[model samples]
Target: MKEKVVAINRVAKVVKGGRRFSFSAIVVVGDGNGTVGYGLGKANEVTDAIAKGIDDAKKNLVKVPLYKHTVPHVMEGKYSGGFVLVQPAAAGTGVIAGGAMRAVFESAGIKDVLAKSKGSSNPHNVVKATFDALLKMRDPMQIAQQRGITLSQVFNG
Candidate 1:
């Protein structure tokens, strides 16, 4: 399968009595050419949390716009309190990102991409919003059909 569970992190919440620990997971799944999915899970155990997150991600797989080996355009989205920006890049550019963002791209089989994450740094929100944005993407074939035009007319014309 092309899908992968990229990273799992232990998170803690401060409470009145003590610290409450939980596991946060980021799962990325893709077919490399264009489709990718990212998911987050929070639970008492790291394995269970990651497994749940991956399952959710698979259930929510999305197809993103791809031009050559990179994204077709730049886009942004917000989830919870995090903002994510995804941009296409030329070949050999590689993925210029860190943290959960990088893992998302890698699992999605993206070799070259540019990304920026802002606002809340929560991994779950960031990953989820990114997936949301990607899921909204439109491919040339779909666009041509929607516009009632040929692919060449829509792109080359």
Candidate 2:
């Protein structure tokens, strides 16, 4: 799996003599297919924190349905103060996104998509919101089933 570090933060705690410092990392992992996951880890060192994040990400892997190397439909998601709108794009459109939202799409193996991240730009919140949108996507087959129609009928109608 490929892993990308979305954010690394240094946290300090006040102590009697001095301050205790630690690191926190947010990571995204993917197999370059349709499986992706995100993780957060904390440790005394950046490397350790990243390692933990990768392991955690593996534990949370999820499969996304891809249609022609793009999202099946428009999607919107929100988490805390972050909101994201995701839409499918043509094959050559490429990934039109930025910052943490870009990382999430790349990790999810989506090659063509149009995304806009609104509200808070916080990487943590953006990542979660992106996942929320991705997880909410449904395949055409599922939609057809839900509508109690044959797959061909869905397309014909």
Best by lDDT: 2
**In model 1, which residue pairs have backbone atoms overlapping below 3 Å?**
none
Q: Give, for candidate 2, the lowest lDDT window spanning 10 residues.
A: 98-107
State the TM-score for model 2.
Answer: 0.95
Per-residue C-alpha lDDT of model 1 across residues 55-99, encoded as one tens digit per residue:
877777766666676666788878989889988888999999767
What digit string (tens of lDDT, one per residue) describes model 2 on residues 1-78?
Answer: 889999999999999989999999999999878899999999999999999999999999999888889999999999
TM-score per candidate, in order?
0.75, 0.95
- Model 2 regions lying over 4 Å from their true place: none
Candidate 1 residue runs with Cα over 4 Å from true position? 2-22, 42-44
lDDT scores in order: 0.77, 0.93
Q: How many times do residue backbones clash in model 2?
A: 0
